[model samples]
Target: MQIQDLPYPDPGVPDARSGPRFLWWLFRNQLGGQVRSLAWGLVHFLSVSALPFCVGYAVQAVVDRSGTRLALAGGLLALACAGNAIGDTFLHRAAITNWITAAARVQQLLARKAATLGSALTRRVAAGEVVAVSTGDVEKIGWFVEAVSRFTAAALTILFVCVGLVVYQPSLGVVVAVGLPVLALAVLPLLPRATRRADFQREKAGRATELASDTVAGLRVLRGIGGEELFLDRYRSASQEVRHAAVRSARMWSLISAIQVLLPGLLLIAVVWHGVGLAREGRISVGELVTVYSSVMVMTYPLRHFEEIAMAYSFSRPSARRAARVLSLRRATSEDGSQAGTAPKGDLYDPATGLLAPTGRFTAVVCGDPDAAGRLAERLGGHPSSTEEEPSVLLGGVPLDELPLSAARTAVLVQDKDPVLLSGTLRELLDVPASGDVDAREALTAAQCEDVLAALVQGSLGAEDPLDARITERGRSLSGGQRQRLALARSLFTDPEVLVLDEPTSAVDSHTEARVAEGVRELRAGRTTVVFTSSPLLLDRADRVVLVHEGEVVAVGVHRDLVHKEPRYRAVVTRETEPEPEEPHDLQELEELEEIEETA
Candidate 1:
């Protein structure tokens, strides 16, 4: 593939049976690039291999005192030099091109797999493993892919040289042929031990990486609990383990490298000694002796590629396996085993909890345990739990697992409590696959996030519009309230048929939360909306409130009636405070407060 065509439009479904199989699949896909690289490598290796012959010819021509033949040798030597330069240049060009394109392809596949798995990716694999596979593993895989063609060329070039030597003088040729194999095979016994050590090092490194990732992700929480020092100690221990393993791995590789150096030198010595014996016997000319020695020296260059290929495969094998494991994860499938149809529409029901939200109504779910609330919210989005055999949420009598991923996602949009905001401009952040019914302004206003837009405008460094203001990664630059509200706005803008929001207003102040609740109730009218919260303002605005204690529904009614009757529901929402006799604030009153806040 061309560099410009990189990031393939379709990275095609991968074969994930095993790491070696996956590597084979990647090789098959890039056969054209592999061919191009191989062809260039042949040109390069062949040209360099011809140099020893040129040198020998020149020596013999001078030894015979033939002026014409010496002149011809000079011309051939110059051509060989030019060929070497041209071939080496193009070979590198093709190898690097293959490397970049292969890396890009793997990256795209990982991205696609992550998107398909959604939040469950972290559940199945450690966050650090995913990070490592996407970053370091990609390059290793590309290294193996790029090395394949060059390795083949090197082997073929070695074979050509060995044959030429055997034909030039049978005695010297046999000695060189036998010696070259010994030199090449000498490191084989050491490879397995080196590879084992390397694997151990990689495992330790991965564990350290995982610990570091977990520490960073929860750094804020760790500091709050005064446990950063404890985590630091743990990470230091992990780092030390990694260091020891790495040292062991390096020692093995160093031994192998030493063997490689020593073997080549020994082979060169043998060739020189044998060539001199042949010259003394008058079985080979002085010129032939020079050619055989130069040829043996030249052989070292191609032999290096054998070690390179081994190293490349060693590093890439595990990386490819890790990537394959991730790609093999499949979402819960339907009972019928198909996912190519239209999205269903109806009451949102969770059979596992026996909780139901009627069609086109705003429903509030109050879970005493926050973790339970988050899990239920994820379930509403068709995410399968490790404990559950399949996703039990259904829409219009059809299980969500039965629907295509695109259809299910379009039908039910879930905004978790800790929603992430990728770095981008305001426009890009809000640019989701949204319904045309809700525009950016309407959604922003409904989410009570006008202040968020105002802050972005005030923070702009240039004459950029509010929509053009750039957001930092994960919205780190914004306050907790602003990030929450901005995410809420994006959800509202999506305008899905069914929306599940978990603690969407937890970060905002009571005043802002009250207005946001009213805005949500009004804008989501006649659409299925389920909010997992204990906030009184939001609960009161809901058309129906369900108290989910433990896992099952314990009580269900309007918020006003439920507060007076269901003590569990009242205690959860009101935090054990005596329920006020008065109903919630009216919509017009909240709107007036919104106007006053804007004026201030």
Candidate 2:
């Protein structure tokens, strides 16, 4: 898969059984790229290794004063140089292709997973951790995958060089072969410590990242409450912890690097010492001695691959583990293996709470606890609740879980209490993937969003339309009420069959709230609309009101009737007591003054 063809047609399900297995799966998927990289890498390293042999032959030709041999050696050197250049270029190309494709594959998997889990993803994984995995962690995994092929080529080149040396000169070849393995394995004992430090550093870094994200998201709130400095200090402490862990990790890796360098130098010295003795005993020629020395020096470059591979594995192990954790999460309904059947076409019902929103009617649900109300709204839209078994909500008479995900979402739309406004122009925000005929202007009017439109027009340049005005991320520039109204307008524009709103008017003033209630009632006259709120104005407008207490429906009736009949319902809708009337003396004095004025 090339980078241009990215966002692969089928990213395919990942083997998320474990970190190592996931890495292996990625490697297997990109086998073609990996093979190309390995092939080119071998060519490059082999050409590099053959250079010493060519140079060694040229030196012998010069010593023997043979022009023919000298010409042959020169030709061989040119061939080796040409091969090295071509191989190096292609190797680089193949390696980069592998890296980009692997990272793209991982990104696709993450995107698919995020879509499947939806909002539940944030509850299962931190927003910061998810960001980290999709961004930096994916690159690290790709780096490991790309490095594996190069490391394999390096090892193979080294082995081939050793075999060539043994055939040319057994005495020095044995010494070189034996010493290379020692150099490579010398740092194995330190890897465990290095890996532990890397894991700790990564953990601290993830926490710091999460803290920073949270701080930025709540910056306005922090400033309002005068808690910005506290959060800053907390982030500072977290960053310091990450720094210390990284330093400790670097120290261990540095020690391993030292061992790698020191051991190779020692091996080079041992090979030279043994080769000189063989030369003195007339067992090896000067050219042979130079070849052995150059080969050992060349081996140093390949030996570093050991350290590179080790470092890659150490960093990628935790990243792969994190990616696996996210991919392993499945929807609650899918986990239990029960097919609830397709979303039925009718009223929305939550069996768990015994609350029913009838078709073509406006229903208001009042709950004492806001959280319970939100969960109920979610359940009504077919979202699973953690506390419930067989967490399925029915649409018409069909269980929501039984329907296809797209069909279910299309049938019932749930607007959360704090709905997100994606960064876009007003027009784009309302351009949702809706199935029914919806007019954006009508929805905006119904949502009481005139003020929002005026604000947008005022913020824009001359002659620019308000609908074309750009909104900042999460609509942070807009007031809470404006954001809420805009969100409601967007939801309305979807024109879903069943619309569930949780405290849709909580952020607006009473006057605006009443207008929104009336508008919603008028616009959704023949559709199911469920509003989870205790606002008296909104409740009084609903055709039917249900009181949900402690997760069950405790009372059902008109808002005015319930207010007088149920104290619990009355207490929630009207928290304060009513004042008494004026005294009898005050009433008699006002009547006598009115009679006197009339006589005069």
Candidate 3:
């Protein structure tokens, strides 16, 4: 596959059984490109290696004083140089194509997995690890894949040169043939130590990356709590640890490099020493001695491939393992068993906790535990839970998990307590796949997002429309309340058959919360809306209020009725006791005051 043909029509499922297996799968998928690279690489290396032979022949021709022989050698030298140039150019092109395509394939696989797993992905894997894998790890994997063809060509070149030498001169050829293998294998013992140190470095680096990610994500919270310095110190320590590990790994690899150079240098000396003795004994010509020396020198270039391939494998192994682990993750809902192109319409029901949200009504869920409330919200939307045996929520008496993911998502939408706004223009943020009569303007009005619009205008070009104003990543530039309102506006704009909101107004004031509650009730009048909240302003607007205590429905009624009768509900919502009424004034004191006024 070429770079222009990128973003493959079908990236195909990866073989994530094991790290090595995954690497093998990638190589197999790109076999055509790899072969092309190998072929060109072979041409290049062979032409370069043949140059020494051409020079030796030219020397011999000069010694013989034959004009025709000298012309032949010159022609052959020019041909070899031309071949080398063409091979080198094509080899580079093929290698780059192989690298980019391989990386793109892996990246596509990762993106597919991430889309399937959704929010649960971060829970299973660290955010920083995911970042590292998708970025640095992907490059490492591509490096290894691209190295394979070159390494193969180098090995073949070494073999061809050795055979040619043996045919031309046995005494020097034997020395070279024996020494080349020793040079390649001599560094094998040091590899284990090098690999161990590399693994250590990678581990420490992952931790450091994770620490930095966490610190950056929570920088605002840390500043609020006066703990920024503490986190900075922690990150500093992690970075130091990573640096130390990297230095140690570099030391080991440096030793391996030294060995690579030293062994080849020793072999070169031996080949030259042996060839000189053969020349002195009149066993071979001076041209043969020069050829042998040049051949040994050329062998050094190919021998280095062994070390390079080793380093590439050592680094890429762990990267591939991480990528495999991510790809191996399976969603709670089985994709194979999902019923395709089906969208169920009716009341949302979670069998796990017996929480039922009836059709065409605003139902409020009051759960004492916020985590439980969040889980219930996710369940209500047919989002896959972490459990295995627990059945998914149902829509219109059909298990939502059985429906295809796209259909399920279209039918029901869930907005979490902390929803994110992707970096883009305001219009782009609201550009979701939505149906029904709702639009951006109406949803914004219902969400009481006038302040958000004004903030956007003030933050950007004053003449620009609010919809055209840009929003920073995660809506970081906006205040918490503004961000929450914007998220609510986005969800409302979608206007799904069923909407599950988890504390949609938790950040807003009571007055704005009341307006938002009323607006939602009016806008979603004939749709199924489930709001998970404990605020009285929001609860008062619900057609039916259900209290979830200890993972089950404990009470169901209007918010006012529940507060009056259920002390637990009252405690959870208001978090205080009700005050008693005072007694009336005495009647005798009123009568005495009336008689005194009559006497006067």
Whose TM-score is greatest here? 3
Would you give me the overall lDDT of model 2?
Answer: 0.88
Indicate which candidate wins on lDDT.
3
Question: By lDDT, is 2 or 3 better?
Answer: 3
Candidate 3 lDDT over residue span 1-600, tens digit each = 789888998888889999899999999999999999999999999998988888888888887797898899899889999989999999999999998999999999999888776666787899999998999999999989999999999999988888888888888888888888888889999998898888888888888988998889888889999999999999999999999999999999999999989988898888788878888999988777888888888778878889999999999999999999999988755544245676778888888888888999999999989988877787776655566466788899988777777787888888999898999899999899899589799999999999889888888875378899889999999888889999999999999999999999988998899999999999999999999999999999899999999988989999999999999899899988678765437988778878999999
How good is model 1 by TM-score?
0.92
Q: Which ten residues in a row are the worst by lDDT in model 3?
A: 331-340
Model 1 over residues 1-600: C-alpha lDDT tens digits?
889887797887789899899888998999998998888888888888888888998999999998998899899989988988998998999999889988898999899888877887888899999998899889999999899999999988888778888997788888888888887888898888877887788788888888999898788789889999999999999999999998998888888888888888888888888788879988889888888888888888888988888888888888999889988887774322235678788999998788999999999999999988988888888987756764479999999887888888889999989888999899999888998899898999999878888888777688268889888888877888999999999999999999999999998999999999999999999999999999988988999999999889999998899899988887887788775776438998778878999999
Where in model 3 is the C-alpha error above 4 Å? 336-339, 577-600
Q: Between 2 and 3, whose TM-score is larger?
A: 3
Clashes of 2: 1
Candidate 2 lDDT by residue in tens digits, 205-289: 8889889988987898899999999999999999999999999999999999999888888888888888888889988888888
- For each candidate, what is the lDDT? 0.88, 0.88, 0.88
- Residue 263's lDDT within candidate 2 is 83
How well does candidate 2 match the true structure in TM-score terms? Answer: 0.92
392: Cα error in model 2, Å = 1.2
Alpha-carbon shift of residue 188 in model 2 (angstroms): 1.2
